[model samples]
Target chain A: MIEIKDLQKNFGDTKALKGVNLTVPDGELFAYLGPNGAGKSTTIRILTGLTKISKGRARLGGYDIEKEPRAAKRQFGVVHQHVNLDPELTVFENLDIHGQLFGMSKAARRARIKELLDYIELTGRAATLIKQLSGGLKRRVTIARALLHEPGIIFLDEPTVGLDAAIRRRIWALIKKIQLRGTTVFLTTHYIEEAEFLADRVAFLDKGRIIALDTPANLMAMAGAWAIDQFKDSGMQTHYFKDRKQAAAFQTDDSFTLRRVNLEDAFLSLTGKKVQP
Target chain B: MINECLAIYRREMLILKRRLIRQMAGQAVSPLLYLVTFGYAMGDKIRFDGISYLDFLLPGLVAMSSMTRSFAIATDINVARFYWHIFDEFQAAPISNVSYVAGEVLAGMTRALMGIIIILGLGLLFGVHLAYGPMFWLPILLNSFLFASLAVALAMLVKNHADQSLLVNFVITPMAFLGGTFFPIARLPGWLQSILKLLPLTHASKAIRQAALGKPVNLHSLALLAALGAVIFLIALGCVNRARD
Candidate 1:
């Protein structure tokens, strides 16, 4: 479980996070959705103790991140937004070092590394250097490394950002499997579909503030189940309807098309800005 | 904390093992050139404290190599921080700032020890032998500790690889040449001697050369080095903490 209260972060004259508050309960897969520079990574960094918070308090598994950093850090595994594995080291070596950093015994590290390599389905590539692996494989190895010490929570920041659609789905399945294992998962992403497909609850963050928070179905239903997009001389406009027949009836011109309302439409209807930059 | 430091230190040792041969070859080339061009060229023409020029140059080479090799950790730190982003891995882990700095300093010391062995081997081949005693290692270690601690502090302060290289050019290069590694500081002007004598490497060179030649070691220089190393190490710890923020 993670708890944040009135969190604020500032860099000189600019504020990165402004009086933001959030709580993620145990075993919940919560997605913090935002565009670029939307304070998603900043919140994660503050929670993980990577960056100092300018104001407010954060607790990870009941340990204060500022006052009890070591204990707080021991409670969570962080898969950073960027690839941070040692390139010269082998896959097993990377996991081994991480386990050792957590004070895991040698035998424990050996067993965990073996289990995780198999879990990530990289048993054959355990001996390969990180630089030798493909992008998707590297991402999997990073995730595996994060889980080596068996922390209670996992913070994944844009885990599948640049990966192809197929690889992204594979990661999505892995995330589901991780959540099923009873670990609380906190994920941040700009991809609307990722949040919709994987999260139990979603929070929309923009300009250092949380604008909307709810289940995917609830957020979509608040707008409508169906949508009609109409193109005019000025620009394209979309209208949401509760019924499929009504949405179809709203499409009068050849330029108009009827489709199901998605999380993106919910975000647009709520904030008047696209979820993706 | 000790276990965490060793974990980081062990990773560096493993990487060093893979590149051991190439590193040894690279370490040998520069000292060999200096020995041939400077050592052989002025073999008997120059004498310091009644010892041959080559003999006097041998210990200075050891001191210089130890300082440079230990200082090389800054480059490694910069690479880990900027390119590999490995420092972020450590930051997110449960390790303390002290553990990270201690681990890196030890790795630097190990590299310095390796360089000392290589230079001593080269000295034997060139027929320039000297005393290898406890006093010899004590000052060498203190010197390595000094530079390596400085290296970690500077690495934390630098913004990028280019900034790191600029630091080496401005700080380490001058100390290498003017710190009595290639020539005696006594030969310089009195005012310059006073300034160079303030350098930690100068005291390192003086103490190491004295211990090598069976001369009376200056306790003041050794004390100064120990004091400086301790202070710089604390500064490096502060820098590591600041860098994480």
Candidate 2:
């Protein structure tokens, strides 16, 4: 479980986060959605003990992040938004070192690393240097490295940011597989479909505060079930209706295209802005 | 705490092991050049305090290499920080700041020891034998410890690779020559010697040479080196702690 209360972050005169509060239950795949500069990374950094918390309290698996940093850190593994693995080290060595840092025994580290290699489908590539791996392969190894110590929760900051759709789906499967094994997952991503598809619950964060939080279906339902996008001289305007019949009736010209409302549409309706813009 | 430190040290040693030959060869080139040019060219004509120039120059080289080799850990730290992002992994791990500093310092000292051994072996091949006991090695260990701690502190403070290189040029390079490696500090004017004595390496060279020459060990220099090493190691711990935030 993860608990956060009145989280606030300030950078000089700039207020990056403003009294954000959230809680994630165990075994929940929670996706935090936000645009750029929304204090997403800052929140992750604070929770992971990489940055100091300016205000409020946070706990990971009952361990207070500030007062008990090492315990809090041990409770959760983090896959950073960037690839932070050692390029000079082979996959096995990278995982081995992480296990060592956690104070795992030599025999335990070997067994766990081998199991994680198989888990991430990189079993045969253990000897390959991180620099020699493809971007997708590197991301897989990064995930494997994070899971080496078997923490209760994992924080993944944009795990599939630049991968293709097919690769993203494969990663989503891996994430879902991990979650099914009972690890609470805190995910942040710009991919609305990803949040919609994989998240047990989604939180839409804008300018540091979460504007909405609920199950993906419930959040999307806030914008109605149907949407009709009409392109005009001014700009594109979206009209939402409770039913497909209402949406079809609302569209009168070739400029209008009717479709089901998506998580992005729900976010746009709530915040009047794009999630990625 | 010991386990975490060993983990960090093990990573550095693994990397060093992979490039062991390259590092060995790189370390050998400079001392060999010094031995051939300075030790061989001067031969028996230049004796400092009734000792052959090779004997005098050999211990000096040992002291100098210990300083340089340990200080060289800063470059590896910079590479890990700027390019590999390995430090980020460390930051996110469960390791404490003191453990991280201790581990890196140990690795730096290990590298210094390797360079010292290589110089000693070259000294044998050149037929120059000096004292090789605790009296000789204790100062070398202290010198390595002081410089390695300084390296870790500076590595944390440097912003980029260029800044790190500038530090080497302005700080390490000047100290290398002025700290009595090639010549005795007493050869300089009294006022200049006073300023040179302020350098940690000067004390290191003096004590190491005294011990290697089988002269009575300078307890004062050894005490200063130990004190300086402890202070710098504490500073390194503080720097690592600050960097973590």
Candidate 3:
């Protein structure tokens, strides 16, 4: 389980995270969504030991992040937003080093890495260097590296930022498989469909504060069941309705079309801004 | 802590081993050129305390190689920081800052040892042998340690590779030339010699040269090198902590 209370981050005179509070129970896939500069990366950095926490407390698996950093860090794995693997190293070497850093014995690392390779369906590509792999393949290997230590919780920051739709779906399936095995997964992404399709619950953060938090279905329901995008010279405006009949009733021309409301619509309805620039 | 240190060291060694051939060629070229050119230009013409200039030049070359090879770690660190983002992984890992610095420093010392070996081989080809005793090696290790720690400290402070290169040009390059490596510091003017003595490499070169000549080495120089190394090592730990912050 992950818990954070009254978290705040300040950079000189600028405030990045402002008195944020959140908790994620074990075995839950929680998605944190926000636009750029919403403190998503700062929160992950503080939790993962990459940055110092200015204020508040964070705990992982009941271990305090600031007081018991090593213990807390050992309880969770992180896949950063960027592909930080050593490009000069082979896939197996990358995972092997991660296991070593976590203090896994050689025999244990070998066994675990082999199992993860098969689990990620990259058993044959273990010997390939990271630089030689495609972007999607590299993302998969990055995920596999994170799981090598078998931590109870995993934090993934934008794991599939630049992949195609097909590749993104494949990664989503992998994520579901991971969550099914009862690991608490904390994820941050810009893809609304990704959160809608995979997240057990979603939190919307803007300007360093979470504006909304609930299940994707519940959040979308709050924005009504259906939405119509009205195109105009000013801009595209979306109108939400409680049902499809109400949404169709508001459409006057071919430029308007009705569809089910998504998490993005819920975010926009709550914050009056798009989730992506 | 030991396990974490070994993990980081193992990563560096693995990468070094992969490119060992190219790295070996790069390491061998510069010292070989120096040995041939300087040995021919002034081998028999001048003598320091009746020792042939080539013999004097050999130990100096070894000391310089140790310093340069150890300090070269900054470049690798900058590459990992700016391009591969490998340091980010380490920052997020369970490894402590001290362990990270220790691992990289050890790897730097290893590179220095490799270069020392290559220089010794070239010296042998030229029939220039020195007293390879503990007195020689103790100072070499201390020299390597000091420079490697400095490398790690600077590597963590610099923002990018270009900035790293600028530091090298301003810091390491000048020390390599004027730190009693290629010539005797005593030959310089009194004021200039005073300035050169401030460099760690000056003491290292003097100590190594004395040991190579089968003479009693200066304990003050060795002590100074060790003291400087410890101070720089602590600075490295501080820089790493700051970088993590």
Candidate 4:
């Protein structure tokens, strides 16, 4: 549903995206993982037509983002990394305006707004102003607004960045439900567990380049099944082992903790840096 | 594009609806104070162009109100861009740059018209009647368009609320005072008159006052305003395009 070919973006002397290429097939839940300033948002911005691409081509649902921006934009819904809803507008009004922008008829907008409010479990708060809502509720309303137009694809850029763990899981379930409904989902995040738990396939983006791309299980397996983490003068240093027995055999006088290898370990093994900076 | 523009315009109208009472009160209070303080004090004392001072000031007040209210959209734009981040939502949507600019400019114009109506009503309350004709609205709209377009362009360039206020203090406030709004431009020296004549609001005041006093409408002023509006609107479009990049 989304195709990016040799995409490059530059801001003067700094390159935000360096010849990155990616393709997310229909109904796939793909996560673009990276640290701060790692080009995850830049890639999403290019795909959503929010920012211009310096080179190469990006297509959304077969429409070129540069040459056919309107049509391309019509094919996808974008939930930006930052909250962008009109604070003075009611929840329903926010969704209503979005539907209208996409040219939905009055009856259609009403029906969609009702359906989305219900879907996001915010029907009771439909008439409430966005500023009155809590952070998690605001995030849900933003998600609902993005889905109002019923686009074929959705780009969620750090959708649950600052939310608490419980709220984050709720959003994760919502995202999974969206994928189950047959919409192609493209998510970007620095949270390793979010990508592991929600994404079908994950791509590691470091310094504007895709360093690793694979399924969570495959990526973890390549890094090893078990990890021994020991606190050092520098920081927490983790050593990977093929199995529990191997990890058990490797011992040190310093205190250590044994845990399962996660996406973070895979990223650290690939790029030698933590995902959170 | 038209539909998208209307959608944005409708959203602004909705916000305006919620704040209608406060907005009208704010709009009404300023002109009323001007009419009471200036109109009553100078009604019998001063005369210009063979009319009462109160009569001469009505059209100028109307012209000034329209300019100030229309240009007030810069504050709204800045709030949306900075505080609310609502511009990003529009950016990611399927709307065209032209549609966004058209919608905002129209919203500003609507605010200007609303201000004009309030001021006109105040004039009626004070027993100051002027000609209400088609010529009156033409220059009013042209003036609103000119300032609204300029507001959009400047809104894009301002970095924050401080910068926006700086723009008002340095650019809009001076124009409001000196743009033939409160007095006749002919009273100024020749050089200052030439410079003030270059302002769109000056032409707007000239045309509106002429129409109000039963003088023949100055097509030259209307034409000048229309030309300035068109040029500034194109500049606003360019600013919108550049801002997205």
Could you tell me the lDDT of residue A122 within candidate 4?
88
User: Which tens-of-lDDT digit does each residue in A72-175 have in candidate 1?
Assistant: 99999989998898888899899899999999999999999999889988987888999899999999999998899998899999999999999999999999
* Winning model by DockQ: 1
- Compose the digit string of candidate 1's lDDT tens values, residues B1-245: 99999998998898898789999999999889888888988677887778888998999999998899999999999999998888888888898888988899999999999998999999999998799899988999999998899999999988889999998899889999999998899999999999998999899999999999888889999999999999999999999867755
Candidate 3 residues B36-103, lDDT tens each?
88885668887887888899898998899889999999899989988888888898788888999999
lDDT by residue for model 4 (A101-164), tens: 8989999999888898889988788899988999999999989988899988999999999999
Q: What is the TM-score of chain B alone in each candidate?
A: 0.98, 0.98, 0.98, 0.98
For model 3, residues A1-277, the per-residue Cα lDDT tens digits are: 9999999999888899998899999999999999989999999999998888899999999999889988998999889898999988999999999999999999999999999999999988889998999999999998998888999999999988999999999999999999999999999988888899999999999999998999999999999999999999998888999988878789888999889899999999899998988
Instruction: Estimate TM-scores for all models.
Output: 0.98, 0.96, 0.98, 0.97
The parts of candidate 1 lying over 4 Å away from their true place are A232-234
Q: State the displacement of the C-alpha of residue A18, model 3, in Å, after optimal TM-score superposition.
A: 1.2
TM-score of 2: 0.96
Clash total of candidate 2? 0
**Which residue runs does candidate 4 get wrong by more than 4 Å?**
A252-254
Across A176-262, the per-residue lDDT of candidate 2 in tens digits comes to 999999999999999998999999999999988999999999998999999998999999999899998888888888999988999
| Residue A159 lDDT, candidate 3, scale 0-100 | 89
Candidate 2 DockQ vs. native? 0.71
**Per-residue lDDT of B200-234 in model 2, one digit per residue for the tens?**
89988888888888898889899999999999999
Q: How displaced is residue B132 in candidate 1, in Å?
A: 1.1
Q: What tier of docking accuracy does candidate 3 attain? A: high
